[model samples]
Target: MQFQKKEQYRRQEIWELVKGKEEKISRNFQQSGYERIDDNLFAFVNIGYQGHAGQAFPNQYDTDTERLLWYGKKETHSKQPLMKRLIDGAITFYCFARWNDDPNFTFLGTGKLVNYRDNFTEVFNKDGTQTFCLELEFDLGDNSIHPAWINNFDASFEAEPPDTKEGKEKYVRHKTRERDPAVVKAKKDEFQKEHGRVFCEACGFDFKKTYGARGDAFIECHHNVPLHSILGETQTKTSDLTLLCSNCHRMVHRKKDWLTLPQLKSLMERN
Candidate 1:
């Protein structure tokens, strides 16, 4: 299908098209700077200005994989800036690539930013001034492209997941179950009773000890039991939960293989 331009559509408006649908409509969707990587993966290319030697900003793509290393614009420096929202692991980006013939973009596919790094590299601008760039990596979930859509692109490809050893190490961490607030509270109380304070089991980081009054009673609860292992509607036992600091909790979910408490503890020791 040929790419079309929607002069009136914004990112939010485009998201509405596939919000609740099981399959996205192949046609009728278009965004600039989006490129099709595979059946399920697409990239939103942020090429620097065409006036410069770099077509859009310079970027690198692994020909053998669905890894597109992209750079952010040069203007911002805030710690938690708006651009950071794109890599926050919450928003699902409907990627698009700019059309060479016109100032339009084509809708590629959907994905989520799995990882990112700031101050990744410095680039010399046309004006001879240097700017730091933020690098981002995205993962395509189950949103595969339609067969008809593949005909419109050059060739269809599949983004490979991690290798055997790496895949085995990475936990399928997406599945989760809702525990009752009472059960969560009970877990915390029991941990406090035994240890005299709630602290990160993996890192031994004590919130109250570090943050004083404001951090007291402020530890996070993590579900130790794998959600998929439970048959059905199983009661959450106190032993099924553990205490974690926000940092540790985030680290546990940072990769596909969710780290067990023991694994994280070992990682800390090695470091």
Candidate 2:
């Protein structure tokens, strides 16, 4: 309850800041998820608010990074106007993206378009429990953007607002480096060093030394859990790894919601 009360005050502060900031918002758009591959970082989810009609796109830190690694249509071309609208608070939606399967990770709801000047240090909560205050500014006021299946879930669509120091952080949060090439390269190198010698748990495959039919049979490492759950934490283990081929690994993160390797295995078994 204390957290909730804090969130309220935070929202009031954000509203006050934006009351007369008057800036023109654009019109063409789309939103998507952003991820930092090497660190296995789930890109921050960004929400776009447009006068009254806003939608969220998964954050894709950079077009090139997203194009090179992620499997979706990277060149689909997003509407810049839409992105600006959402960021500027003309539209409001719960635009969040996360990996639900990793046991080692926790869930977080994040987005781009931060409040004033992207001052994350002053806005986030102490324990970093959640970002409730940031979301209240564009509160849909009893509107539900989630699908029907999730409509009944008890998430706050509209509440008094967040006022906590933690709630305040949302306004200052930005994607940081949604697609930092340096960060990605470093992460990849780290993963290789730690997992290069390890074998795959599912098939005893070796990724570091060899390839498969495509070439050497190197083992594939998996997060076992989602990165969003592990954000702000350091040191992940290779033992929590699963060895699969490129195909299997791709299939693993496909669903993004309630999708897990074990669950995939179950589906395979039934078939």
Find the candidate with the highest lDDT and give its number: 1
lDDT of 1: 0.50
| Tens digit per residue, CA lDDT, model 2, 1-271 | 1112112222222223333236321121112233222212222233222211222322222322221111112322112333233332223233222333111221222222222222122122345442322121211122422221111111321223323321112222333111112222233345557766444444444644465443332333444553323444344444444545555555554433424666767766777
- Candidate 1 lDDT over 1-271, as tens digits, reads 1223323334334444434345553442344233222222234454334533553456544334444456655643324423433433222355554434344444434544444566754666677777776666544333443322221111221222222320122223222223255555666678889989878888888878999988886676666654434554566677877778777776775554568989888888999
lDDT of 2: 0.31
lDDT of each: 0.50, 0.31
* TM-scores of the models, in the order given: 0.39, 0.29
Q: Candidate 2, which segments miss by more than 4 Å at Cα?
A: 1-214
User: Positional deviation of 139 in candidate 2, in angstroms?
Assistant: 33
